[model samples]
Structure formats: structure tokens, C-alpha cells
Target: MNPPLFDLTYCPIVPALEVIGGKWKPLVVYHIYLGAQRFGSLLRCIPTISKTMLTQQLRELERDGLLHREVFAEVPSRVEYTLTQTGLSLLPVLKAIGAWGRQLKEQQAVPELVA
Candidate 1:
């Protein structure tokens, strides 16, 4: 019997990108890290994103095992999203990425105009 062959020969980043490569996924994760658990709160936290796009992003994150969505049985049918253990493990990496972004912005800052 032959074993199944897995293809990961290109680069190591590919797998990571496959999990969190989209423009919105990182932002969604960041917002969730900041305690935006509910759908409405997430929408408000990232106002620039459309409702449809947010929905898509949330679904993808949930499907990828980074997010856990819980629904309550009640009249209003409340729902919430939280980071799973795997998702929480990515927090340090996310923070480092944020720090790099800030450092890059600072390094590229334009000089103030003079009179």
C-alpha cells in the first residue's frame, strides 16, 4: 500500500497564508482579540467592512477553526464569536505584526512642513 503524498514543497509561508491570507481575516482576528465578540460589535469595530464581507470573513474564520461561534437559544437568538485555543495561540504573532507595522510607519514618516 502507498501513502498519500502531501505537497508543501514551495514555501513554508504558503500554509500560513492559506489559513490567514485575506485582507479581512487578519483584521477580523485583531478585532476579535480586542474583545469584539458579538456580530454587531464586530460590525461596529470595523465599520469600513461591509456586512456581506464581514459575514464571509466570519464564516471563513469559523470554518478554519480560528473562531468558535456560539448561538443561544432565546427569543432574540443571540450569537457570539470567540477565539479558539489555536486562535489564541496566534495573538503574539499578531502583536508582533502590529508592532512591525507601527515601526514601518514611524520610519517612513514625512517631515513637517515649514513656513
Candidate 2:
């Protein structure tokens, strides 16, 4: 029998998914891409996501080296997030996935009936 084409032990998709696979990570990344750096801005961009969940997701992304969290010394202690090079590299993949989603939505749309 031929060897399997993919090595299950070290599948590339597994690592990628480990880094960005979650209900909120992709949306977080998408909003960050659109210049939602501050906490309030990110929260506004994805209002359906709970504040706690958003914090957890951002911390995970930062831990995974996909984002950089900056802290400013001020009266209120401002914080912001920016994508790291690793995170930026995934932009094209995200864009392609978005395009595919739009295409699928278009394909599934019901045409209007004319009189």
C-alpha cells in the first residue's frame, strides 16, 4: 500500500488551526485589519461578542505571536493591539476565505420572480 499523502503527525493545517481556530479569533483578526486597535473599537466592531470572550481571544492571539498588545502610560492606561508579521501573513488567506463566503452566499441566493 502507498504511504498516505499527508503526515497526520505534522499536518500544517493543524498548527494553523491551533493558532487561529475559534468562533471569535477570525472575527477579531478581521476587525483588527480594519483599524480596530483599541479595546473599545474592537468591542464596537463585534458587539455580539462578550467583553470577557473578546479579552480571552485577544490574549490568546497575543500569546500565539499573532498580535502585539501595547500599553500606554496615561491617566487611564490605554491599550491597543496590532497584528504581528505572522498575523499579517495570514491576511491573504483571510481575504480569500471571505471571498469564498461571499461567493457561496451569492450562489445560494434565491432569484426574484417577475410578473
Candidate 3:
């Protein structure tokens, strides 16, 4: 019997994609990689994302072992997010993707208006 064209279980990229897929995932990771981040700063950095979505993504990332969330003992409680070793390893790949996209955008962009 012939195998199915695309098997979901055996594909190597599946796990990686699961951890890093979606519009906000990479952006969230990239921002955290810049330095450890808090909820408020991530919200500011990614202005278009809603709080609900951010919370969901962060939870998934933490579940996937790509993020470490720390809570401090304080009056209001402070939480911070940072990359785990696995997440740090993925940074180069993400950076490459970002560079490729920027190059494509530059090629398609209009000339800048100099002051």
C-alpha cells in the first residue's frame, strides 16, 4: 500500500513549527530574545496583538519548553519571560527569516523622501 502524500506524524518540521508557528509566535520570541520581557513591554512592542492572544501564545511557548516565566514576590507581583536554551538556539533561524523579509520589502518599497 502506498503511503499518504503528507503524513503529519513523521514530518521533522512539525514539532519546530508547532513551537514557533503563527504570526505572533516569532515576534514574541524575538522580542523576548532582545532581553527578558514582561507582559506590559511585550504588549507595547507588539502593538497590534490583543492581551488575550498574547497570553495564549505565551502559555503555549512555555508549555513547549521554549520560554521560562518567572514570578517575583512583590506587592503587585512581577512576572518576566525569557528564552530557554532551545529558544535561544532558534534565534539565528528567526533572524535569517527576518533579514530575508526585510530584503524583499526593500526591493518592493518606494524611495524614501529625504528631509
Q: Which candidate leads in TM-score?
A: 2
Q: Once model 2 is optimally superposed onto the true structure by TM-score, how far is the C-alpha of residue 26 displaced, in angstroms?
A: 1.3
Give the alpha carbon lDDT tens digit for every residue of 12-38 in model 1.
Answer: 777888888878889899888777389
Q: Which ten residues in a row have the lowest lDDT in candidate 2?
A: 2-11
lDDT of 2 by residue, 1-115 (tens): 6547676655668888889998899999988877639989998889999999999999999999989999999988999899988889989999888899999899779676779
TM-score of each: 0.83, 0.84, 0.84
User: Which of 1 and 2 is ahead in lDDT?
Assistant: 2
Query: Which RMSD values do the candidates have, in order?
Result: 6.1, 3.8, 5.4
Q: After superposition, how far is residue 6 of candidate 3 from its true place, in Å?
A: 2.5
Best by lDDT: 3
| Model 3 CA RMSD to the hidden true structure, in angstroms | 5.4
In model 1, what are the clashing residue pairs, if there are any? none
Instruction: Sort the predicted structures by TM-score, highest score first.
Output: 2, 3, 1
Clashing pairs in 2: none
lDDT of 1 at 61: 87
Candidate 1's clash total is 0
Question: How does residue 85 of candidate 2 score in lDDT?
Answer: 88
* Cα distance off (Å), candidate 3, residue 51: 0.4
